[model samples]
Target chain A: MKDERTVPARTATQVKIADAAIRVIAQRGFDVVSVRSVAQQSGLSAGTVQYHYRTRQDLLLAALERSVARQAERIRTVGRVESYRESMALTLRELLPLDGVRYEDAAVWVSYGAAAATRDWLAGPYWSGMRLFHDGVRETLERARADGRLREGLTPETAAPLVTALVNGLTLDHLNAPARVRVEVEAALDRGLRLILRD
Target chain B: MKDERTVPARTATQVKIADAAIRVIAQRGFDVVSVRSVAQQSGLSAGTVQYHYRTRQDLLLAALERSVARQAERIRTVGRVESYRESMALTLRELLPLDGVRYEDAAVWVSYGAAAATRDWLAGPYWSGMRLFHDGVRETLERARADGRLREGLTPETAAPLVTALVNGLTLDHLNAPARVRVEVEAALDRGLRLILRD
Candidate 1:
């Protein structure tokens, strides 16, 4: 039987289509993402795009896989720090909309969150990415606790998921009101972390 | 000069169309919400729907206005209380996706939040509604402090907005993974609030 977990090898054309799909989703909301739109954005023929992705979901899945890989690589680079406080800040901020690229990525994730609210098939991947992020926060919190860097009377299990939600909420506010939230984003993160992390 | 703040009178046809638009958005996602879609959802002729609401934005704005008024009324009813903790819980819980109607409202707000990321016109309303909600949280926090019910070392100004983001984050998480988040939603809110509010 074919391995459902294994991603098929992607050709250069497929890569181009996937990039185009992400750009399309980032530029116009995910609602306008289609094979034709991706093809137009990629400067290729509709049939060429179709041969690679076959459907809109196929295109989005490929784009999401790439985005997830890049994000995971980023978080991995920040792992194994001496100070869980610094590591915690970096890892969580990596998920925030701090730059143009991250902003677009956040936009796609937020739109998909809404789109997946009704599409059950999309929820699996959404939950997977979120669970992965949440686990990272939990690990950071646990490490901080072990190192005595976390405040007393707080458990990682209880606080980690809450931190995940706080970042998610802050990201939402930042994407929607960048100017208003930009000045306070870093400060807000520090304030939140201070509640559990030692000064 | 025309009064921009005063909403024009809504006929029965307009009210029906607005309700149809909300349902359409709640079920099909906002991408499919157009005059024709709302018309079909409302069982009204396209021309009839068009006559009352000239554009998709008009229909959406009407629906949002109705939704906002209803949400505000619900929040207003929960305004004053003997305990700020209980009041905070109730007020914030009103915004959570705890039921079908609230699930639909959060879906629409989250979708608009993503949609407004690039659209300047939509951003105004998005920020306005969010700012209104944030203001209420700030006021509640101040009241909690005056009553000596808030935890020490916390300012309403600093903590209120973070609480706003926390709830926003929790709402997003709940909508995406209802089963996983439903069990922990209330407890999560209490934990975050406890960081600021006294026991």
Candidate 2:
């Protein structure tokens, strides 16, 4: 079996198709994502796209996998820090769709999540990505506890879900309301974290 | 020319089609909600369904509007209470997807909200439902403030989003994890509310 930890090798054509699939999902939502549309968007023939991804699920899964990998990498970059509070605030903010690219990524994730609700096959990607993000939050909270930076009564296990949910809720709100100011979004995050973290 | 607040009188056939649309959305997700599928599920002809709805949005929006009306009515029935704390808790609990029917409602809302991300026309149902729910929370908070039951530092404006987001997040989590217990979901909400409201 191919190791999920490592990014699978892809030809340039496959990469193009995957990128096109992401754009289609981000722009039109996931249910509308099809091989023909991805091909049209990629400026390639339908057969070429088909050859790269034999089915619609194959194509969309590739796009979902790539997005999750990139998001993991972004979270991983926030290495050991002097303050878990600052590190967390910085990392969670990265997940917010404050700009165009981030908005597209958030939109695709939301689309995938919605589809995954009913389709059992799609649950793997959705849960795995969520696990990674939740684990990251737990790790950050644990570090704060170790360093005595976290509030006296709080534990990572309890706080992780709140933080994860806050970000998820905020991301959805931000994507739907494009007119929302970044300051308000950031402020919401800060307020949530303060409730969990120490002063 | 239709007053949105007024539920349009539906023939038995129209009502059947609308119920089928809700099932389709709850079981299959919203992306597949079309006049043809709804008709197939309802055992009615597509042309008959179309005659009532005029457009796909009209049909789905009707279903959505009906669901919101039912949810609001449920919240309204929570009635006068000795304390804002008890009233708020009782009202918000109605929003949780604790049972099968409630779960279906929450799932359809999430699916519709996800699709509404890219479809501008669908924004009406999405935002209007959200506004009603948010306003309910704000109204509870305002009542608490008037009764002097609210925490000293909390403002309805700030607390409403946090409460709203927490419920939204918890609903999403519960839907994804069907084995989730009602107690845990209720506890999460209680914890979140405690953080926002005074004892």
> How does each model score on lDDT?
0.77, 0.74
What TM-score goes with each of the models?
A: 0.90, 0.88
- Evaluate candidate 1 and give its CAPRI docking class based on DockQ: medium
Which candidate leads the pack in TM-score? 1
Could you list the chain B TM-scores for each candidate? 0.88, 0.85
Error of 2 at B111 (Å): 1.0
| Model 2, span A17-97: residue lDDT tens | 777887888788887788889888899999888776778888878888767766677767856555667678788877777
Candidate 1 residue lDDT tens string, A38-105: 89999999998877777788888777665665577777886555666666777777777777667667
Which candidate number has the best lDDT?
1
C-alpha lDDT of candidate 1 relative to the true structure: 0.77
Model 2 TM-score? 0.88
Displacement of residue B108 (Cα, Å) in model 2 is 1.5
Model 1 ranges with Cα > 4 A deviation: A1-16, A43-48, A79-81, B1-13, B178-180
- In angstroms, give how far residue A137 of model 2 lies from its true place: 0.8
